[model samples]
Target: MGWFFAFFFLSGFCSILYELVWLRLTMAQFGVTTALTSIVLSMFMTGLGLGSWGAGVLTRRYGQRVGFPSLRLYALAEFLIGCSSLAVPAELAWGHRLLQSMTAQNAYSSGSYYLASGLLVAIILLPWCTCMGATFPLAMAAIRSRQRLESKRSFSFLYLANVIGAVAGAIAPLFLIELYGFSGTMRVGTVCNVIIAVSAFALTLGGRASARSSAPVLTPGERRAVTAQPKVLLVLLFMTGLVTMGMEVIWIRLFTPYAGPVVYSFAFILISYLAATFVGSFVYRRFNTGGEVDPYLSWVLLAFLGLLSLLTSDPRFPLNTPLRVLLGVGPFAGWIGYLTPMLVDRWAAGDPDRAGRAYAVNVLGCILGPLLSGFVLLPLVGERAAMLLFVVPWMGMAFLPSRRQEALPGTRMGTRIAAYASVVAALALFFTTKNFETLFPDREVLRDSTATVIATGNGMHKRLLTNGIGITQLTPITKMMAHLTLASLPQPPRNALVICFGMGTTYKSVMSWGIPATVVELIPSVPRLFTFYHPDGATLLASPLSHLVIDDGRRYMERMPEKYDAIIIDPPPPVRAAGSSLLYSKEFYAVAKERLQPGGILAQWLPFGDEAVQSSVARALEQSFTYVRVFRPVEENGWHFLASMQPITERSADDLVRRMPAEAVSDMMAWGPAATPTEQFDRMMRTDLTTQKLINRSPDTPPLQDDRPVNEYDMLRHWTHYVHSGMRNWKPDQYGAGSNPPPAGESAQKGNE
Candidate 1:
């Protein structure tokens, strides 16, 4: 039992690691702008479900009839899983290439391309993930044969080890990412798989795994114990799998804003969930040894307490507020954690045949859950409403007494009614404490497969949040972004590509140039929401010259090499958000450089939220571009980094204004403190910095890399160090490397406001 525990533990860890990285890799290929995440997850779970059934059949028919031990088969499954770690990366890279080729065809829209890529990913991942499912059954069969463990004990001990390993697999990558990049992490997973195979092979040499003959058929007493209420048990298992998996999807969305959109954000929630689940299962292993199980009423009470934990979690709680965040997320984590493994233990009873078949049924429900949440629940009712919907069924489920519970006729009606009212009171608390949509204004909420887009405020005051993170806003600050970079160019710019369509401000400003423009936005809903921000959004969306593309900025550039005069990258803010690292990586700049025409410029927006982030951005820009210039976008704390392979000449404010197309000048002044174009240009010129000089001050500043993402991970450190001690605004040295940067000139003041 000890040896088998170790063997399964290692395999469980490798399985999660592979699943985590592969999912990220596939999302990159297919574009995770829709419910594509749900598709990939569903497909992976579907493979697991099918594989469990197939493994049971193979073990029953061949292992017993052919006179071979199932433990040896477990060894082979581990080897195959090991082999898959190598194949997966290569296959995903190829799929990305295929997606690139397919995107060039005018016949296909972005939606169809995503669908095709999804199919390719499914084909690549299903085989390895299916092999993952086989481990549970094979190990169970081997343990049962040894007679060192009974049906109940076998599943509990094995489940405990698997989940413990799963907790590690889910979290280790976040720390490993700084040491080893995406490819490096995948290699680490392959190594773990190899360890599992070797360990399992050792187990085959002795112990119950060594048994080659089939055991006698179960006696009447054992048969009855295993078969009792099999139908109800299966149904309960399915419901748990479905509800938990569906809520996991919702939880990821719920927690993203609190954790930031960083790569590790999802891992934090997963770790919390698995950790809590391990606690529950561990508790069950200790207490649930006998044939008797806790009644459903007790489980219902726990569920109510869990709902309280979730209801208290403010949806818009700042990521930096740890206590509030933990309080908010704790409830859901506690509820599912206790119920899942406990229920599985009861249904399977450690019988290899029953365990394998029953676990497969649960996995199928997991497959459906994500699809149901992403496509049906999320899109139809929105996040808050969906959460409320989950509570209704959960509370209702607890009210119905299980078959095991025998109540004297009508004796406990008052007690039951009070219990029901308590559940309703918790629901009422969640509703009265509503309106955490502070991430954006309360104008309109739009839900799609990709994200829930919310628009708030009115006219140019509107803000946007794709999911719960503040994405973009309608403001003149955005207008200045287009004019500042374009005006800085020494030569006339004829074409431009706006990488992110944030409130369509930069895109609209570019169109004001009246030149050919291309706007590439990742989320489709964001582009569609432009009308709510800008009055003329409809005209710009319909413009022949303004080409709006629903594709990833990086992927779009990869598909088409430098074909524009200038490209402005206005990525979503806080600089530490997930996927932000990819945009800031040195490699992306290399890709962007290929598409620029001669003397072309790439303007990047950097919200100087932290010193590390500011330095990291500067370092990356320095590494990529020959001539890099940094400007203070506002008098307070934002920056604009203009980088160009072509030398950037510093023209006087009047001279630059003279070169602007008449319409471009009009766009700059349209929403500014300045009454005229010259005044707006003067505001941009007041805060220029010699980029090389600023880089000199931060000689030891580390650059943001694909592997070591300094921007995304530093917030954890910041939350601890700066939050405790008052955070100081660490401004870089003087504009000319004088160790003191003068404040933005008074002339730029009105415009900044």
Candidate 2:
């Protein structure tokens, strides 16, 4: 029994590690759109469901006649899963290459692209995920054959250990990836799986009985009971899976603002959820004495808990981020943790086939939940209302009329009262609570499948926020991003490209050069909200000179054939944002180099980061470009990295101003603290920084790469610095006064305007 627990604990750890790594790898290969993310996750769950059901069928038909111990089959499954760690990366790379070739031959629409990429991903991932799903039933069969009494609650026992292991997995991989790259981290998972397989196989070889199970020959009464279990149990399991996973997607969107957009923010949410779930499952295992919990009361509690996030997430509330996540998500996730295995155990009755079927039904709901949330609910109703809709099912289930046989005597009135009270509380929360958008009286809010965008503030204070995190503001800094790089060229740019269209400021500035400017924005709603920030936004957007492509910037560059004289990349803020490394990585620079014409410049806007991140990004640029120049923005504390394959001339302020056209000069001074174009150019030039100076801050730090996102996974480094600084009473002011700089756009003072 101890060995089974250990086996499952390690198995669960490996499963989550694979999920995190694979999802990231697929995003790198495919585009990083919401739809692509949903497809990858759904395919993963689908594979698990198919494997569980198929394994159950095989066990039911052949368990009694098998010549070897069932544990050997479990070991074989683990061995295959371990091998996947090596195979999957190569397979994904091949699929990406194939898609690229197809894309080149035919101009694929967005729908066609998704279809082709999703099919390729499903083909690559399904087999390995199936092997992951089969572990449950195979282990259950082994336990049933060896120990009859333990088999009765084998599912819950394994579930508890798995959840515990999952909690560790949620926190461990961040540090692992920080030390090793993605492929190296995967190698660690492979080694653990191999150890589990070797240990399981050795146990089977040590004279374990190969006997057919005596418990398979069921009596007539037992057979009737097994066949007659209520189908509603399956429905309940499905609902739990759907609601829990859906809420997770919503939580990320709602909490990102308060927690900041770093990778640690996501890890904190997952840790809270999995840790609380472990407690619930542990309590269930300790207390399960063949007694049933009250279904009506449980449903009522879940329905109310489902709305707890509304109160905690409200801007009017005083809770901090960690408190908000814990109070909002903990109780609801814990209740689900308690309910899921209980229903599965009751329905399965120690039969591997029945448990497999029940578990697969749950996984089916898991597969659909994120898709429904990302595609349908979030885009249509937004986060607050979508959460309200998720609660409706649980509320309805709580009020469901009970059959006479199932109803407990004298408890009906209390259950009814609790159910009514929960509905009232949910309604109250819906009516009174204020979301992040409501914090500003003057704001335009828009929702799309990708993000929730809010254009808020007035005059120079105007800002663009996606999913509540402020992206960019109306400032001259954005204008300089276009003019400074374009004017530095000895010859005028023929055409240009802007990667991120935040508030359309840079895109608008680029157009002032009177060249064809193309802007690629990830969020569709962000482009639509341009008119909210600038009065001439609609006019600019309607002009023939402007072209808007709503897609991931890296992906757009990969597929598009047109080369630009200047490519300006202002990746979304915070500098340590999850997936931001993709833009700053060495591989990304290699791609950008391919898209630049001879003597073209690539200007990268890095809002803010610590020494390690700054050094890593600086090193990447230094290695990628022949000539690289770094400048501190005149108004804000951040870098503007200008890199070019050709020599970037060090022109004087007057020379730079002379290079710009009349319209470009006017646009540069439109929102400036400077009185003239030469003054504006001079102010920027005064802050010129060298790439070598930036890299010298952390010489040991390697260049940021696609495989190793040093900026995103810096929790361990930050922690170590915090401890040493505290001991020495040091005031770390390299980037700012505190351990973390103020979130990108927030750092600039209003006086700067």
Candidate 3:
């Protein structure tokens, strides 16, 4: 019982720690956009597969030998895992910084950032990943040798214990990493390794005097291990692995927009697998010795139900309920865990000594499943389709024959009614909720449901209000706003361009100005989805004068040919995903200048943020262009900047007010708002104070790009800074909880004059 408790805790702790460290480094170094993170995760699986294959060789070569000490071996594996946690972070930081510097200098313009990120990721991942992968097999080998059992009872029982441990390990990271950051999570993991090493050593030292008797070796053919049932079981487990991998990626994709601090997001999955494993193992331990059909029958039923649930459930269902519940407490584990003993019973048959070999092959499937899913299914077909494809092998498990059959004794009448009702209910709900999000689209829609709008700019002309001031004219301009602004700009405006293409309002504005403008957007679904929700948006996107390129704004600027007299960066706030971080990076500024013609004006719109974020951005701009001046349009929350390669002076507040459209003139007449006080301008001027401080205090963490490492913490800090800055600048009834008002519904839209 002592040994059982020790192994269970150690196994769970070590596995979860390994994953937490692995995921953190992957997300940080590779930027959040790529699918390669999945490839790294699958390495742990590969390691398990290799570990399983090598276990037999290890046990046979060292089981009874004096030199091959099991206690020392266990300690060594734990130490390796500890060492991996530290080394992975350092390596990730180093490689990420190197790429950032190279890209910033234009030293590697020939290759895309994605390619560079991938190559750097490969160098860091391959070695540590392989080492991490080796632990599971080593663990299983240690367990089998310690027990040294002849009966199926001991083998099944010990294997069942290991399954529980694996499940526990899988679930631990979700909570630990959340409470503690990744660094703290790794520290917890190190302690787990030490405990495992110490306990194994203590157990071995106590049992040293009792050497097990050697059993006669058996050949593969002599054992009659080539049974059809176990083979079917193996296939079922492997298919489950595929589903598990696909589910993980799909879940992340679905959750990314709504959730923050999503590291422990896979907890549901871990828990579900754990529950299934516990139930399956417990049943097998109770009934396998008696050759009762109940154990095998339960496994079949669980797998069938799990697969059937998946097939009938809508992939884009509004809620993550079914997926989360099944992931935490479903048949995923029943498939992965039950197969191990079933294969052992077949291959080892009556010979307990050869059972180690059967267990190793079972571990191999764990490694292969994720790798195949990441590199093949995920990138080729979307996550939704990959999940649908998992059902084929799971259904095949029904036909396998076994020594016992445990059929339910239910009458035909009861079974028929349940089955019929299930079919009708599933079909009815599937179609009913398919575009359910259109009813209410906002932050709440994302918070409570799975419905994601591909293009938000389309449906309504959402005003971009900052600090209680509207900047609608600064973003998607209407024909009236564009016509007015273009008539006002100094002539030779034939080559005007826009950095953001929100709802094509700015494009309409630019077209009215008679300048051919190009717009860049990151999300591919945005243009199309917006077209569905907003009819006007569809026409603007297909407009003759505008070209909408689905590319990062900074990347597009680096390669674009037009030398525009005016380039409007009417971008959405930095609060959205990676968009905010990319905007502040020095690399982006360098590219922004390269696209601008001499004496060209660059307009940047910014929201209120803390000293750090605001100043960091100001410093970034200062570093890029010679003339950087801040502007506060007459409206509230309307902060703007006109930067240039040439020196420029700020115009008087009265002149700025005078140079407005009629509505803006009307608003100015109505409000008669005071100019920003001298104190506020001084605060704005202090934006350069912390640029050097930030650079010095920051660890040499690389600047984020499509290929750069993503620092979720760093980005979160940026948001926090933004929030604080907003609070500092807040006036009564301006941007806040209930005190400030919400935007009126889509209709009576007043253009940000």
Top candidate by TM-score: 2
lDDT of 3: 0.48
* Stretches of model 2 off by over 4 angstroms after superposition: 209-214, 217-220, 291-293, 402-411, 727-753
| lDDT of candidate 2 over 107-194, digit per residue (tens) | 6666778788889999999999999888888888888777557677788888888888888777779999999989998998899899
In order of appearance, the predictions have TM-scores of 0.86, 0.95, 0.61
Report the C-alpha lDDT of model 1 over 668-701, residue by residue, as the tens digit.
Answer: 7776667766666666678788665556645655
List model 3 lDDT by residue over 421-471, tens digit each: 444443443334322223334411111011133322233434332211122
lDDT to native, each model: 0.69, 0.83, 0.48
Which candidate number has the best lDDT? Answer: 2
- How many backbone clashes are present in model 2? 0
Candidate 1 — what's its lDDT?
Answer: 0.69
Model 2: worst 10 consecutive residues (lDDT sum): 731-740
- Give the poorly placed runs of model 3, Cα more than 4 Å off: 1-8, 60-67, 97-116, 147-181, 198-229, 250-304, 307-388, 396-522, 527-753
- Candidate 2 achieves a global lDDT of 0.83
